[model samples]
Target: MQELHDAPLAPLTTFRLGGPATRLVTATTDAEVVEAVRAADESGTPLLVIGGGSNLVIGDRGFEGTALRIATTGFHLDGTRLELAAGENWSDAVARSVEAGLAGIECLAGIPGSAGATPIQNVGAYGQEVCDTITEVVAYDRTTGETVTLTAAECAFRYRNSTFKDQPDRYVVLRVRFALEDAGGLSAPIKYPETARALGVEAGDRVPAARARETVLRLRAGKGMVLDPADHDTWSAGSFFHNPILSDEAYAAFLARVRDRLGAGTAPPAYPAGEGRTKTSAAWLIDKAGFTKGYGTGPARISTKHTLALTNRGQATTEDLLALAREVVAGVHAAFGVTLVNEPVTVGVSI
Candidate 1:
């Protein structure tokens, strides 16, 4: 275990923003992780569990207590079953699985974060979510001070949310277990229309695993979803907002608002989210609301390559980013009666 006091946290995240933590501990083993969490809880100190920091937004005020950075390393693959330590870099692991001819996670190849954090948000991309392959999550339960295994069903995963996210302070993920498929080196059936079109394959067609992974990575790069430190557009938390899922009544009201504003010929993109729920494109709403790509005059702005990503163009504070986010949210709500919600987890701040 490595420990530091008053540690700067900006370098830890993909956005490269945030202040510092009063205490920062990098735990290289699951035992150390538990020990650190227990000590903080026993001392009645607030705790922040950090993974790759890719999906986190820490405030300028900094964390007042312990910030535990999980760095434990383990990757076990028994046939189609895979177990990963919380600290394993997510994108790299996806690449490895592709190399091993796995079919389940090829589309998630470019998402930046730790394997542990993947379950936290049920991280999904290119129409494939971690929830689809995750069989079990082994976490250190802070409430009971014990390690417990929760099945995928118990995780209660939804679009970009899970039990771990709902009770952020209650559990520190230690390991994640997944069940991948071996389709004789073939990828899973393509589900996203864009990906299928890019590959020149019809939806539900299977391509080579490597081709699927590379194609997804290329698509992600185009949208600034893949991490590229030199590019300001890539200095974001992938998509800034989740696609808004509204109830039937809410969707009807929103459609009325949209038609009233954009004219009878105009229509907003909508997909069935579940029974009686509709998911609408937040990117479309933001654009229609007049916040175009690369929108904003400040250091923080929408990514030039993607309308949905809010980015830090080298010199931006958390407040600056949040201001741009709030502006986009308010603009969309005023124009279409749909409120956008942020995808990244925020600390010491609310939007």
Candidate 2:
């Protein structure tokens, strides 16, 4: 374990907009992670678990507790079953699965963060969610003070949320196990229309796993979703807002509002989320609300390449980013009745 006092946290996150942590502990093994957590709990200190730092937004005030960075590494593959330590890089793990001819997670390529963090957010991209392949999550149950293994069903996986997320302080994920498909080196059936169009194949068609992974990476890069230090647009927490899933009544009202704002012929992106629920694109809402690409004059602005991402243009404070986000949210709500919700987890701040 490596420990530092009053460590700057901005450099750890993709947005690069936070103050310092009172104490930072980098744990390279599951044992160390558990030990660190126990120590913090015993001392009654608040604990913050950090992984790849892709989906985090720490405030300028920073965390007054111990920020534990999970850096453990382990990737064990037994036939089609895979087990990864909490600290394994997510995007790299996807590539490795593709190289090994696994078919389940190819569509999640280029997503940032650690493998352990995937279950917390039920991370998904291009129609594939971690819950689709994840069989179990091994975590330290802080409440019980024992390590426990929870099955997929027990995780209560939902759209971009899970049991771990709902009860953030209850469990410390140590490892994740997945059951991937061995589809003869072919990718899983393409589900997202955008990905299918990019691959020049019809939806439901199966291509080479590597080809699917590469195609998704290319698409992500084009939208500034992939990490590129040279590109300021990539300095963002992927999508700034979650696609709002509204009830039938809410959707009807939203549609009426959309027609009122953008003419009766205008149709915003809508997809069936579940029974009587519909999911609409947050990107479309933001764009239609007049916050187009590169939508701010301050250090924080929407990505020039994508409407969904809010980027930090080289120099930005947490307040600057939040201000831009609030503006986008209020603008979208004024244009349409639907309110936008942030996708990234905020630390010591509310948006």
> Which ranges in model 1 have alpha carbons more than 4 Å from their true place?
none
lDDT of 2 at 39: 97
lDDT of 2 by residue, 153-214 (tens): 99999999999989999999999999999999999999999999999999999999999999
| The best candidate in terms of TM-score | 2
Residue clash pairs of candidate 2 = none
Instruction: Supply the global lDDT for candidate 2.
Output: 0.95
Q: Compared with the true structure, what per-residue lDDT tens digits does model 1 show for residues 1-351?
A: 899999999889999999999999999999999999999999999999999988889998889999999998888899999999999989899999988988899999989989999999998888799999999999999999999999999999999999998998898999999999999999999999999999999999999999999999999999988898789998988898999999999999998998898898877898899999999998899998999999999999999988999999999999999999999999998888888999988999988
lDDT for 324 in candidate 1 is: 95
Question: TM-scores, in order shown?
Answer: 0.99, 0.99
* Model 1 weakest 10-residue run by lDDT: 261-270
